[model samples]
Target: MTVPAATEGTANRPAPRQNKRNKPTGVDILVLVLTIVGAIAIAFPFLLILINSFKSPADYNSTGPLSFPGSLYLDGIVNFWERVNFPEKLWNSIWISGTVAVFAVVISVLNAFAIGIGRIRGNTWVVLAFLLANLLPQEALLYPLYNMFKAVGLYNNPWSVVIIFTVIQSAFGTYLLASVFGTFPKEVLEAAALDGASRWTTLWRVIVPISRPTLSVLLIFFFIWTWNEFLIPLTFLVDNSTQTVPVAISVLQGDRLMDVTTTSASALLGVIPTLIFFLIFQRTLTRGITAGAVK
Candidate 1:
């Protein structure tokens, strides 16, 4: 009995129970691998374009699209800026996109509030109508929209493009915000009402603050789409002076490496703001899309 009472040494002590944290499942590892591969696949093209933007014309031609340029050259950048009237175009695009985003967000927010608060009766039908409208191909509506815009004397005007993009994009934004709003707690609205808050007061003071993620998503999407828009602007604004960056880039034509370099540089400049916007609002963008997909 005395021998059996010997104390255990530190090394002889049983190991502490393993932490309860679960290891990554096989499915998780598979998903992680797929996500990495998919991300690299999508990013490679942009990486190539960015690298090529800095290359000399000769280096660009001799190198593969995926290859690194031998050295950076300002010639491509210089030509892109000079030929495209980059400053003017950039300023114009800023105004166009900014205005569109402002108007779209304003209108969409109002729409979302109306539906989300039950002010708009038959909201489901309204949402369905918008979905149906978007389902129809753009080509189907071009002639009709053009005829109407022309009839209204909006042709060759920047406003024509701005207004068109706002209206066309509203359908998707409305759907997006509506879905986001659906995930909101109904009890909060009831509690506000019980606290003697008016509908407008509750929305402004409570709902809007909580809805930041969704609103940020809408703002960024509308901004990028309007900023990079080409077809609508081209169709509406026939004059070269009103050409958007995408349409302007298309005019850089020549059967030479220099021309290609110029085009790539112009494209790089055009895409810079979109990158900035996404980087700024990326958190909301991810959360917004995932809100309804999960519990």
Candidate 2:
């Protein structure tokens, strides 16, 4: 019935001390401050755009860029949308960017497979060629491209922009993916080969499944890049109905002067779709980043 000396003392021991509020260290406070400032820095532009997007010219003139609007104004947005033929522009962008993303990823996969996994002779030169191609300025190619497309009767066509960007974007993708595939687990490739998988079969069923995250990230990047591309799209898609959002926005600016609010609304509309796309696939991008860090 009697407790041991150690057990008896345990019953009488002071209750575990409650957690105390620890004042943040200087380092912690500095980090907190930096994070707040960084967030505000990043978010301020979007906030400004959203605020000004809702302001009428009168409200914006009265209060300026920093101030919030007194009343919501949807007119600028609606007017810009209609004026720009936004629905057509939106569809054009989606089609071009989507097509470029898919084509670029597929081209990249094929190129990377040849240079990296296949370890074909002269792959270093091939990869270097890809890198150099990416470094080549769009400006340098413009006149030549224009002449070529015009000769082919494809000038001012959306497909011209599509073809140009698909090649351009895939060049970068090939360079990046070749490096990734160069470090691919050799064991897996050997396993697939040992299983009597043909080279084509191994690439699609084995390599692609493993590389999906990276390809997803590349696809998203290619889509966003193509969506935001101005020069080629503007050059190749002269008609209002064929223009992408960026080209339309630029055309809107050059063709007429815009009051601050209308300009802000136009910019906001341009930014929202890509921002939404990024947010949607952000987690996949994160995974792709870390996939290399671990097994």
Candidate 3:
């Protein structure tokens, strides 16, 4: 009797057991139930806004928030759009948010590269100072920032809000990115140096490419945060032309004077742009987050 070497190696081993499917346990069911409930809770307000936005004020008052509209009514949307010059507000939001996201990411990358990759002196203190800056109340800084902008003639300008939020967002971004850069693969950086790449060249050709996923995440967050900002934009962008979608919705609606339907329509309109932006970028957002886990 004879056997091949591979067969001989396996001859003494017992047969492998088949994998069993595990049924859901009590904990699994509980977690799923909680997740569903949480989603509904988060979505409830948006749902109400959507439902009521199309209702006439009279219909809304009569039927309450839960009732379906008998027919789609768009006067609230039309009036609100024309009243606020919604197109201009939308453009303002796009410009400010896009500019802030780009500028903040660049500033963060520079700061993080200096502190983390360059290993600059007193970096710990610098990072701590930035962290503390984040902790300071926006209200506390409001007075000084107002005076500073006024002195510079940036007051009542969108640029004022742009500059303020660019610095603010970059502080947090630097804090976050510095840590990521600290854990960067030293071998990769060393290889670039061996290739006679200068610091600037290495940053653009190596570090920036590898860190792009994280930068994408930061950019999207900055845009959304800048888009939703209320107080700073309200103070700085007082004029209708420079105001953002959020400011337009709040200021033009004049809550006291607005019909309930119009108010709902206004809120829904404000939410729609952010929601659409998120949806468009969601894939990139997800990819950026998961990139670290795999590589």
lDDT of each: 0.77, 0.92, 0.91
- Predict model 3's lDDT versus the native: 0.91
lDDT of 3 by residue, 1-295 (tens): 8899899889988999999999999999999999999999999999999999999988988899899887898999998998999899999999999999999999999999998899999989988988987888788888999899999999989889999999999999999988889888999999999999999999999999999999999999999999999988988887878999998888876644888888889899998999999999999999999996676
> Which runs in model 3 stand beyond 4 Å of their true positions?
1-17, 293-295
| Predicted structure 1: lDDT | 0.77
Q: What TM-score does candidate 3 reach?
A: 0.93
Q: TM-scores across all candidates?
A: 0.82, 0.90, 0.93
Off by over 4 Å in 2: 1-32
Candidate 1 local lDDT, 1-295, one digit each (tens): 4434346465578889977988999999999999999999998877877887888878867886667788878788898888768777777788888888878877777777777566488989888887787687777878988898889998888998888778777877777677667667889988999999998898788888877666777777788888877777768766657777776776554322455666678778888877887888787789976753564
Report the backbone clash tally of model 2: 0
Residues forming the 10-long window of minimal summed lDDT in candidate 3: 249-258
- The candidate with the higher TM-score, 1 or 3, is 3
